[model samples]
Target: MDLGVKVDNLPAEAMMELAPRVEAAGLDEFWLIEDLGLAGGFTQVAAALERTRRVRVGLGIAPAAVRNVAYLAMEVATLARLHPGRFLMGVGHGMPEWLSQVGAHPASLMAALEEVTVALRRLLDGEQVAFHGSHVHLDRVRLAHPPAVPPPVSLGVRGPKGLDLARRIANGTILAEGSALDYIGDIASAAKGLDHRLTVFTWLSVDSDGDTARARLRDTIAEALVHPAMSVQLRSWYKADLTDAAIDALAVAGTPQDCAAALRRLADAGADAVILQPVRGAESAQIASLAEDIRPLLDAG
Candidate 1:
């Protein structure tokens, strides 16, 4: 039932401004994402963690294909040591086009992810790793300075195979934006019997004026639907319904009461944490409403 806000596409300067606001507003977590050619996740996370004293900072994911396992482990360990109990580290398969554009996409995603997660975890746990997998090759690698406590590692993945791998190997799972309630339930069922954190990002907009909230939310969903992951996944699950603008069901928007109710449903469906992602330029206002209006309800319930 942790409440978080996703800082998607926010610039570094804005993050510096927003991180404190998020903390001051009483939000529990501030999550960020690293896309191809955008700001680096580790640097942004460092800035956010430095700026905030209480709220936890997280990378929704940094692509595994683009980083060496040893280097990734080092970066994570450094942050964990510097900011104990306050960083959630997520890594997984990035977009295929982006990965291929950079010539980093693996031939077999399953093999690459499995190898990376295992090696990365071992390295973070201060174990000497000598891995020689198809995608990752480590030669008796061990961190010079490992954190006494390892940071939580989550995979940003979807589909049955990917979820299975995350459940088996990683510490947690991250469901991407626009995942339906039924879909979340399916993932929850999959996540049972394991001590995994199920973090989900849903399109979010909340205002006292319900119309304004829904309109802004619709715009966000419109953009989200065009993303390759959302498009393919929604079409596969909803099929003909996707053609009818079914994005509303995938999003949560309205007045504070409405938004809180939607979040309650997600919590009931087994979301360990829900990160509210606003449409472009709507982040600050949404964060305020989440902190002031919506969060209290979730807290009370």
Candidate 2:
């Protein structure tokens, strides 16, 4: 399995700086999130790709409801042509409340996400697409300059139905942070007969002392456990009370050996790539440890 990191919750300017650091650290991929008001995923991806030569850059997700499929395909094609195999695209249904606030929520979230993903992939593959689904409509649209090597398109979603949709249409699936081993294993089991790739995001914090590293993630884990979407998935996967002890299964935290073990467990559960999302205040240090410390342990293991 490959290892990667996400530029989560960091200031927009950090992308330029972090991109090089991720590459220099010998990580395989660097990912960017497209939150409601954050830096645009496509723009950040373009900038990061321009700044780095080797590391693959991914848009962990761009909401399907907001962007028009044809135009989105153009943006994707432009980046793919420039970066080729170095770009990975992920699209999904936006958060319900956030989408509603922006008036971009579709009546049928599943249909909208499915339609957008299908159309986008077809366009990127240099095929003329005429798709008319619940939320996406295109009239024989095609990209004039499709990349010779089309980038993989993953779907960022959680839930059985959404996972099924991803397996049917996308090249891979992106699981959100707080995805536990059981959840990943179940998803992997379901995809056992296929070639679907799994990219998992998990909160990360590291210290020489295992307890200290886990302590740093206490508040963050608590906050994540309360999220509507994450809570449902986590609660279903974990029967025990949600506490610091649960951190080992839910996140990559603790000493280098502990973090390495946690990551290896995720990889064993069938994650193709585990993307570390650092704790808010300790982004740089956590990443440095991931490269200088945890990575070597994983390699040796």
Candidate 3:
């Protein structure tokens, strides 16, 4: 089980500054996101890869509707060929609003996702593909230089049906932020009988004092509060009285021991990898603690 950090909503300059530090810290991976109005995922990852030799770079997801499947295959293959086993590329049905704004949202999102996954997998495998599905169309395309060992294509998705689709077509699934242990269990159950990797993001904040660490996670907690899925899980799983103060308890925040316990719980609940998404302004410290303190604890246990 690998432990990693997500670099999101941060400036490119800030990320570049952090990349070498993340590498020096002995972190397993540093994941990036390609949101509607932010830096491009692949390009940013390429820069990180260039800056670091040890830390693997991952794209949390690229929207399947935003680009041609064949082209995406080429991009991922080129990066994999260049970096070998150091890149992880994922794709998904993007946020509906982002897709609609870009005029790329399909009428049937599930169909589109399935089409893209199937075609992308074939292309990555170095096969000549001529796919004509409801959403994706290709014309006998094949990568001239495919990866010798293709990186797993993960589907960034949520809900039971989405998990099922990912298990059927893609090698892995990326759960959205705020997914709890029970939610991960549900995904694992749905993916039973299939060999699928599960990578989940959790809100993270680590400080020497528990109170300070919890305080740093307020914004992340507030963001999770609005998520309908997370709200439901918090209510059912914790069965806690949902107070403002109590809500902060949902995240992996507190002292190093506390954070390590939270991570162990998630790994026990069936996560192949857990990417800690630190709140803005707390990334560097949280990442350092993740590698230096939390991971050593997990390993020792």
Candidate 4:
């Protein structure tokens, strides 16, 4: 039940300021959205690292389609070097539109990701990656300035095969299936009792104003409009009037007590940490409120 929250908006100076407040709240990590559409992930990460002292800063899975395995490994290594043990990396196969928008070829996504994951780890170990892989290779390249201590890796996966890949390769696996707890058993079982962390990402809104919470969720839920798997899961879980065909149940919008209670449910289910991805128009007050309220549940559990 560790509380981790996403950071998408805030001024350059405000980002640095965000670190102290986030740390003060006893959050396990600051999950920065390396949102390509909004800002450079590295840019915000550097700022977060510079601004915070002990709170770990993690990229919320930089799209593997956006960069090659070599550059990706270098970037994460650089972040770790800059902040020492305070840096972490995660990777995800992003949406088709974002992949196409960047003109990055992401076809055969499963194969592509499998290759990327192995190469990145090799580079992190400061070894020359000489794989003759289809998607990624180092040939003779190695990390010039590698991390003194290897940071952790988490996979952003929603499907079965992706979950299996995570179990095979990553230190931990993350689930973002728009609130469907149906797959937790399948995902957990795949881990085979490996001492790996499990994370679940969901939309979390907390305010006394109920209508305002729902209003904020509408804008955030739009992406599910085009994703069927997400839509089906949401419809099955809470019977939400899930209009979006694509978006699953990644978001949870409700009053403070209700949201807090739901977070406890995730911990009770199996997640070590619950990443709070607030959709459009989310505010820091929600986090501030959670720090004031929900943390006790985790400690008690």
Best by TM-score: 2
Models 1 onward score TM values of 0.94, 0.96, 0.93, 0.86
**Tens digits of per-residue lDDT for model 3 on 64-181?**
8888888888899989999999999888888888899989989788888889889888998999999888889888899999999999989998766777788888899998776667
Candidate 4 residue 236 C-alpha distance from true site, Å: 2.5
Candidate 2: stretches off by over 4 Å: 235-242
Model 3 weakest lDDT span, ten residues long: 235-244
User: What TM-score would you give candidate 4 relative to the actual structure?
Assistant: 0.86
For candidate 1, lDDT tens digit of each residue in 1-301?
Answer: 8888887676789877899999998988989889987788999999999999999999989888889999999999999999999999998878888999999989887788888988999999999999998999989889999999999999988787888899999999999887878888888898798899999988887878877778776655666666666653454444333332354467678888888889888889899998878767877877887888988887887
Whole-model lDDT for model 1 versus the true structure? Answer: 0.84
* Candidate that beats the other on TM-score, 1 or 3, i.e. the better one: 1
Cα error of candidate 2 at position 79, Å: 0.5
Query: Could you tell me the lDDT of residue 139 within candidate 2?
Result: 92
Instruction: Enumerate residue pairs that collide in model 1.
Output: none
* Candidate 1 off by > 4 Å: 223-228, 231-248
Q: Which pairs clash in model 2?
A: none
User: Model 2, range 189-245, lDDT digits (tens) per residue?
Assistant: 888988889999998889999898888888777777667767545865344555667
